[model samples]
Target: MTVIKGCRLICPNNTHDPILIPDREPVYVGRSEATRCIDPRCSRKQLEVIADWESGEVTVRQLGLNSSAIDGIELEKDRKCKLPKGGTIYLLVGMYPQRVEFTYKESPKSPSSPKTENSEKKNKEKKEALKRPASDHTSSNPKVKKPRISSVQGSKSHEIENGSADKAVEEDEEDIKQLEEKLKILKKNAAEKKFAFSSDSEGLLADNEQKKMTSSGKGKRGGGETSGSSLSKTLSDGSSLKKTSAGSCKSPATKSSSAGSDSLNRSAKESEGPPATETKWQPFEKLYVCTRKGVRARDKIAGFDIDGTIITTQSGKTFPTHSGDWRILYPEIPGRLKKLHADGYKIVFFTNQLGVSKGKTTIEDLKTKFGSVLDKLGVPAQILISTGGGMYRKPAQGMWDFLCQKANDGIKVNIDDSLYVGDAAGRPEKWATKKKKDFSCSDRLFAMNIGVKFYTPEEFFMFQKTAPFSLPEFDPRATVSARIVDPPSASLTSKSQEVVVLVGFPACGKSFFSKTHMIPKGYVHVNRDTLGSWKKCVDVCAKALREGQSVVIDNTNPDKESRQRYTNCAKTAKVPCRCFFFTATITQARHNERYREMIDKSHQPINDMIMNTFKSKLKVPELSEGFTEILRINFVPKFKDSKNERLYKQYLLEK
Candidate 1:
């Protein structure tokens, strides 16, 4: 790999100095105190070169350059890129071309393998042949030695040293016009070549035109490939699209000679479909819809979670305060999506932003930011944002169901090809950003609900296998059919009038079971949600017991203290109190909550805090808690007319 030795600052009276682009930290280039380079001629923190130390992949971004005059870096195009090895990338600070040169060097260790030894032999010969003539030219010139020595260090600095021998490229006023014309032609040809070879493979190949980049800057042959490449939405169709250098989306009409052409053709066949229905703010269950204008509904859908998956704050903080404080997380994200779009997958973004409903951020601001983000991404996509909590919130399939049934022009999604990727994968704390656990296991549950494959942002974007996700304890997938809990021949007496104290989490099937089975058996129902207090609930139960009628207390009697009041009331009435323990797991309870909230408008949404509270305070019920009879009530699946064994299906869509 080629290494950059120094940067030439083209300011009057300033001697040439070495500017090393170090790895990892953001190497600031300008007149700021914090910047690595302090050039009075350059603006404060005008440009930043972010480098990965190991691979030497450098991405240069403009921070506060006030002018459009800068040539290599473009604010409009977001021209930050991985700097090619063995080449010079010219960025204009004011009007002069700031040359960053990669110098060839001999490693201390000899090559081990025969192939490597042979390759190294060829490289050494090539370097010698190029340098052999240059040494004579510079020795005769004499003037090149001092300027080059001060500007670059080590044995490799000789080649870079020869270029500044005239001491005129950076400071000579007379050569400015000549340099400007030459630089213009070079930049134009380079831009054209970059546009033609769009992918990372082609980007490296674009260096072939380096001979024309600058008549002064010499080109060296470098052997390598992009060391790291990473993911979202699994693509099994064997379809792909070649991205352009400017990273613009080409109509499926543009054919590429690259290998991706086969994938692109395959994608066109997959994407062929009726036009998708385009609508913004199409209301559904207190949620708003916004589909990208030109997107079409296809059999295969590539769903993504927006914020942490697609974009992150440029500030490097976990959360962004302003709408504009965001950037595309990975460059591969755009390229991959463009390919997917070309291949025929309907790309959709499903995001939940509670801040919108809480007035921390406005709907208009979020929508505007989203529009700009998509515009910057330059891909057509359907968007579903659940601003308020309920069925539309992730972990529930309300948004997915809506997209499949209503938004997609009546095309049923193929779950085999469909996949979802999100950052809220219930991962351990600080999985992506420091000091941040995933907000919930909602994304995984969302995919599970819709019967599709799931992936975390790290898995999808960076192609990394993270530690096993800490899944929601209340996964409905594991909670199967509910078993009927028959009493041990004691509580089945038809004339017995007893108080049944139900026990479980908030969303447990206590109330549902009470209404469906217990009510039919002449048991009067009493609940805290309906009566407003447990005291009132106990009073209602007492009134019912006094009337010689059975009563079911349908509140989450989580611990001994909460259950004590109800048990004591029944004992005072001289009735044999029955403890009906609803044996639904947390997963089953959460599944029931999600289903009820989305399907039935009359049903209130179950808060996470309430569920957590019950989970935290829960104590195992014993016969010691003053009960004559204890019956284990296993969750029994109930559907109005559907017979699908998958209970989650009832809440999602009509089978």
Candidate 2:
């Protein structure tokens, strides 16, 4: 196998002798003699070049404010590109071009192979050849030639160096004029093609051009393959489109020939529809956002929920039957959206598709469905999909935060002018014609979280009167009670050993109250979660009371049957058993549960099904159930900082 022994940077103008590229170390190319360029437009540290001898490739990273081109493709600041052998790097777009040259040598099959006398002589000659200047023209240039040190005096050498520097500067000025002309020609061609620059996505490659480059790159050549053979999205401003909350949608029609060819073929085989409906959606963590082409950022944003407000299942089922089983919800939706766009409002769709996470549907299916919907709508918009229960899901502000921070192209949204329309406004059944109760209240709470005006599909498009609806019963902004005990005279801690059983809904502050008030007071804490069973909880409580210690049972001992085991354990230990019944309502408990999910991400999410099961099994604790005393414990929330207090006060639960 052949391997690279050395590499050099060759200036085409013969400004100086070929500069050797140090192996495995970065060399800067800028306004310095070390790089053989004195152009003032180039910064002190413009391009960083590193050569890998094993791979026989040079890596060029842009570090300066000015952009550089590698193999005719623009390389932005902080972006790195691999330069194959014979690839050229143009500093400042066609000024001071440097071509890469590699020297190769054949490697022996094995280290044990014996070297012959003839082979040793050839190796010596090869090493000497590698040390000499790469090209004959470099050594022949009189203006850039080095003065003979032994014959010439110091002043004569200094004068020669000054003359060469002056000549290079003069040539640099001429190169600048040529660069301006090239830029003008590029702008003229772009205008002729009717191509407009977009901040999010730009520099689309033509299919024919990409095919031509790829076909030519497949053949073996003495110089090597160029990296520019692949189609790429290059930004004119040297800024990258981050895979953040805001993202640019991929159009299947203009898919890159280099990378998307295989996927496009697979998509064609998988479905028998318009290939243009299939877009390659990229995931940003848990959120999947696609901002289609022609979507422009504006101060006023008109947001809508996807499933019920914009589209409904054509199969007349609660869930979609297939990717194509959806249609526009109302006839006026298209006209309303077009009017908003004309009024300078950017349309955005936010939807929660838990089916994707549950494996009922894939991201590819959702992308195809979303693309088709946009095509039918005939208006460009951005779609945000939250596939699971997380910060990005509706009722949470992850999607809205992404829009404000990334999707708006740095434009600050005017919340007063912006509005959101959705069917899930917490309306009860019979609120509209043949209407059933909405599935969830996440959409309404989503708008509330972002402090935007909200409407339903009928209200926004058909001019229907605002109907009566209900919000969550538990208001997080309500002032919390300061009194910890309802009776006010009940003793928090007993002088003797006792077992305190807690009875309330899940997330009613049982664990928090136990850890805060009882644990510090020498009460042993027993939880079913840590023990993994109610039997273990009873056993631990029995042991604690037997050891003459008070125990706080931190489980949601809702029913009398579940609470009897602990009471029986206390009876065996001859200790009094008391019940601390939390005074929070079920709605208030659900609110607290969501608040914990937001603040402490590690806290396991308690979904609606689990909460509903607890509600059905609940049998409010009574003093008749072998409890010596029953105290009503009020949940008084305390915060250490104002930031936390503000976050807690926000409405977290939709229902």
Candidate 3:
């Protein structure tokens, strides 16, 4: 038998056949080099060695004729051919026949050794010994039985029958007394032993002492082989041994005392742990926020006006007066609406669309257009158009009532705490020349009537800047600066009554007075500094008064021309208007000398010239020009009076 590492048998007739011959198993020599026809019945033909296996080289080749031809081929070692199966094959390159045989050897199993057998026998003996009775050794010794209680009990019963019960009882009493004496010694020794053991060890001293007490008590109850005499001996030995150990352990006691002190110190230190980390409690800082008066914290309702308030649309347009018709979002409207939404305000669009009832445009078209506009701006609001015609629009309580009903339907809004933002009349009035309808009657008046504070977008932005309602604390020493200018044309009117013009040098007290007093009284205090454009200040003041709002021009209206602009606004609004000018001496004006100092300190050379010019032109208003009223102000005396006494207590009370 022979084993060949690499060799492959070939069948020339079946080129694609995968089946190997069962009966004709090929013998692999060092290599296989035979081209044989697979069918035994085929005719003989000249054969050639197909594969070879040499020292380091192995190869295979095909040399059979056709499919049906029989080839007498024998394999032998010749040149080695390295087959693809990773072994060598021998080819009969010299044409000599070499026979080979194959064989296999089986591995033997290891036998058990003597050492293993002896260990098994030893384990069996120990197990058997463990099963033996404990009493067997004692039963063989009669002398041992004399001292045992069980044997003594049996002997006492036998002795009682032999007339000796009294002696047995006396012996039992003696044993008990001995046991009591032994127990006292044992407990003392155990305590001393525990003390010694604990003194030597730095840790677990208290724990070990506690454990010893528990173990000693349990041993007495269990009544184990530790006899009373043995317990006493153990106690005496333990005590003496503890004394010796205590000396050696004394150093550890100092260490242990430190350790125990450290332990108790640790225990107490552990008990005290981290001093609870003394969590630094920081006080909550209250943030400053501006809010409207009479507004409740829980109120969520918001009312918005159509027309100029939300869009730049006016009447007589191509579409109906509906908010959707030609009314696009104002540039600042989205941000305002978003802020209101975040603050939990339920935005509701309230508008007076009389055009719809008057056949100007269909309601369906208005809704469609309005919906589209809302989609674009990403604002969702409930639209309430007052097409019922009879004063249901704004300032009328009807719209407010409707809103209240909606709030009751889980809208989460407080009608009383809500705000109305519009640009119309808040109340009706009759001028000597004509009867004027309240423009804000539909929205503004309604809001006021319903106890909701009203604001125009302009006023809203203005209040937003200074947070006047918020009443922030001011630093007296802090330098403040502001540009003084006229109000917007849209905010002022001629028919307006009681114009209050605030005048001061840079940072006296003009703006402070206007904001503190005039605003709360529905006065249109026109500060030119608040206006975006100074050139349009007069026009804005005129427009505001014309709209029937009392105007207060916050500017240095020292000359007549500037004062006349405010008077004209009052006249146009068909209401009484008067110029209340602020007056002070040069010394009083120079009280704001810090502003002059600031101008000088500034790097700009132009500021010095501008400040000089402003100081030169500063003047008090003249009583000429047929003014409806002229008021002279002594600011220094008033300021001193107000400071000594609360200003709100006197001036604010009158309003």
Location of the lowest summed lDDT over 10 successive residues in candidate 1: 224-233
Best by TM-score: 2
Q: Which of candidates 1 and 3 reaches a greater TM-score?
A: 1
Measured against the true structure, the TM-scores of the candidates, in listed sequence, are 0.52, 0.58, 0.24
Model 2 pairs whose backbones collide: none
lDDT value, candidate 2, whole model: 0.74
What's model 2's lDDT at 456? 89
Note the residue pairs that clash in candidate 1.
144-165, 231-460, 231-461, 232-460, 267-343, 271-344, 430-436, 474-587, 482-635
Off by over 4 Å in 1: 1-271, 274-285, 410-412, 430-436, 479-482, 486-494, 524-551, 558-575, 585-587, 613-617, 643-655
lDDT of 2 by residue, 1-655 (tens): 7888898888878886787887889988877886677777788888898988777778999888876765434566786778745667877654577887888889886653356765776677545534444342143433232433435566767777767766764564455456567878887544433312233343343455444445654211121233323223222223332332223222333333424433322322211111123333445535678878777776678999988899999999998889999999998889889998888788899988867655466666988899999998888788988876556777877899888887666666767778999888999998888989877677888888788899989899989999878888887778988999979988988989999999887888888898889999999999988999988888888888878899999988878999999889988998999999988888888887777776774376687787788789889888888999999999898777896687677777666
TM-score ranking of the models: 2, 1, 3
For each predicted model, how many residue pairs clash, with residues at least 3 apart or on different chains? Answer: 9, 0, 73
Judge candidate 2 at residue 475 and give its lDDT.
Answer: 78
Model 1 TM-score, 2 decimals = 0.52
- Residue-level lDDT of model 1, residues 1-655, one tens digit each, is 4444433233222334546655566766655433333444456666676656445466666565442122222232244545444323333322333434434454466448998887777677544533333334333422223454544455567656656654543333333445556778887545543312225522232334433323323222111111111001111232343343222223333243333433332332333455545535553433567877787877778999888889999898878979999999888899888988888788999988767544466556878899988998888888888766566777667788778778776555667777899876767765655647666677776887777888877788788876466654444445555456755454532367777788897777777778887889998889888799977987888888888898888888889998888789878888877787777766567667767765564465676788788889989788899987788877766666553344355333110
